[model samples]
Target: MGTLEDLTDALARDVIAAMDEIGDDRFFEKVSKLLLDMSPTTQEAYMTAIRVRLAERRARKYVEDALHAARAAKAKAPE
Candidate 1:
């Protein structure tokens, strides 16, 4: 429904602003509370999406870490 989509987008924007203001220490807490406030089906769907996003983040971080390590090794190698 349009109303549901509007509410979801509004909530996402507000939560993002709140997360920025609150900082990392409480960001997960804020999200967790948001999920807990939702219906079971909504919470499950949100959690699934969150998991996918987090996995993508981890994959990107792993690549970045590997590249950094390779650069460090190349810099330190015999030259």
Candidate 2:
């Protein structure tokens, strides 16, 4: 059997992809509940992985938006 980390990470990625494909934002919560029934430790690890990935995605978007705005402002400024 794979380590807990590997299993949890893989599950997290698969759950995210499934959620995207199904267009259900609450899918993670459902999966978390299911995992809890099976194993609380696994559920917690999966939740942590999901949260970290989602947070990173949000952080990246913020950085991208800021960069775009900075470039637009620079373009508009006097040369």
Would you list the clashing residue pairs of candidate 1? none
> Candidates' lDDT values, in order?
0.62, 0.92
Model 2: per-residue Cα lDDT over 1-79, one tens digit each: 4599898989889999998899998899999999999999999999999998888888999999999999999999999
Estimate, for each residue in 8-70, the C-alpha lDDT of model 1 and write its tens digit: 445555555575686753464456567778666555544454455556767999999999999
The TM-score between candidate 1 and the true structure equals 0.56
Query: TM-scores, in order shown?
Result: 0.56, 0.87
Task: Please estimate how well model 1 matches the true structure, expressed as its whole-model Cα lDDT.
Answer: 0.62
- Give lDDT for model 2: 0.92
Best by TM-score: 2
Candidate 1: segments with Cα more than 4 A from true spot: 1-21, 24-38
